[model samples]
Target: MFRFLITLTGLLGALGVGVAAWSSHGLPAFVPAEQLPLALERARAASLHHMLHTLALLGVALWCRQRPGLWLNLAGTLFTLGILGFAGGIYLLRIIAGINEGPLIYVVPLGGFCLMFGWLALIVAGWQDSGAPQKHD
Candidate 1:
């Protein structure tokens, strides 16, 4: 279980790094040579990062059976939701004007709060699991 968490975390960390690098350098290959940096930043941070983080949370959630793992996974999931709701809403509103999502943007803060609670739960679960005394038969 620990190994699984480590592996998923590593993947997320690696993805974050790759995204940072790509946003800094690789976007020009796809975008027109004339677009401003702000547009690119918005796309990379809110769009690309949102997608990557969502996938990372999903991967982590696959191992959510153990207590600590579940909390960590939940936290990751909430954070992913926050990104999708908050950043993603704005992205969609800007890029997909015809699709009326309405006041779903109001849910963004709730998602953010969930993300924070998830992290706190993860920390507490970790401490409880680690600090428990092992039983001997």
Candidate 2:
């Protein structure tokens, strides 16, 4: 579990950087000037989610090293799900083949919800941990 989260963090970070670079450089050439702004906007949104969730996953991995709680684990799982569903769906919807609406469209809001739930779970864990005594090593 520990190694998986760390590995996922690294992979997600790399993917985020690659996609960001592609959005900045390659996407402009492929999209028309008039439609460039919208395309770039969605790409930027997806890139932001990917990068931010990568950090969250890293934090969860590090947190698990000290103490692996259920909420913490849940947060990590949801973060992973959110990244796949949210960013993946966005890329498929906007970037690939320019298909605006598709079956994956349902996944977008669910992904966003997952991301929110992930954060909420993290917050709950933090609050619970704060109420408990800390063990200094």
Candidate 3:
């Protein structure tokens, strides 16, 4: 599981960087002059979330190396799903043009929710693995 997480993290991290670079340097070429601003904005937003969550995934992977738990595994899974749904949705919507009004619209928000839940899961994992039970009287 540790190796799997690390490998996934590496792949996603590279994808995030690639998307960021593409958004900044290559997106303009594909987007129309009038639509470029909105396209660029969406691309940038996707790239930002992608890169941030990829880092979070890396942290989770590293944490798993020392201590693995249900919540930690769930967090990693959610983060990976979130990146694919959120970033991938935006990229599709912006790049595909006519499909903006399609069902893909829901994917971005769903991904955002997953990302938020992943953080909550991390919090749970941290508390669970804090080492030693605390006494409150």
Candidate 4:
């Protein structure tokens, strides 16, 4: 699971860079001149969020490698969920105009909540480890 999370970080990081490049260079060709600014702005926002969360997820994964606890797992899960749902949804909305998404749109904030809880859970896990035996392996 830890290894998977690390691999996921690489994937997300690469994707974020690719998206950023597209936003910087490729978007102007596809989107209309009038809407170019809007498209670039949204794409930049999504890319920034995606990259930031990728780093956060990477940190959780690395921490999990040593601690291997519930909170670590939860943090990694929530970060992934938040990245996919929150930033991912924002990116999609710009592309797909009128798709019937229904309650799926709510995933953004729900995912954000999950991320916040995940970090809080990590803090709890750290507290649980206070005065405990330390093992790097």
Root-mean-square deviation (CA) per prediction: 6.5, 2.8, 5.0, 2.7
Look at candidate 3 and tell me the lDDT of residue 25: 91
Local accuracy of candidate 2 as per-residue lDDT tens digits, 1-137: 67888999999899989989988989977788888899899999999998999899999988876767789889999999999889977877767657677675878788889999999999988877755443322
Cα lDDT of model 1 by residue, 21-90, tens digit: 6656766665465553654666565656455555645554543543334566566656656665655554
| Poorest stretch of ten by lDDT in candidate 4 | 91-100
| Residue 69 Cα positional deviation in candidate 3, in Å, after optimal superposition | 0.6
Per-model lDDT: 0.54, 0.85, 0.85, 0.75
Q: Residue by residue across 23-129, what tens digits does model 4's lDDT show?
A: 78877777778877777777777777788889988988887777677777788888888778767776666533422377767766776676677678778877875
User: Which is the better candidate, 1 or 3, if ranked by TM-score?
Assistant: 3
Alpha carbon lDDT of residue 62, candidate 3?
81
How would you order the candidates by TM-score, starting with the best?
A: 3, 2, 4, 1
Instruction: Please give, for residues 12-100, the per-residue lDDT of candidate 3 as tens digits.
Output: 98888888888889888888888888888888889889989999999998888778778999999999999988888889764645366
Poorly placed runs, candidate 2 (over 4 Å): 130-137
Model 1 regions more than 4 Å off: 33-35, 43-70, 76-114, 123-130, 133-137
Better of 1 and 4 by lDDT: 4
User: Clash number for every model?
Assistant: 0, 0, 0, 0
For model 2 the local lDDT of residue 85 reads 85
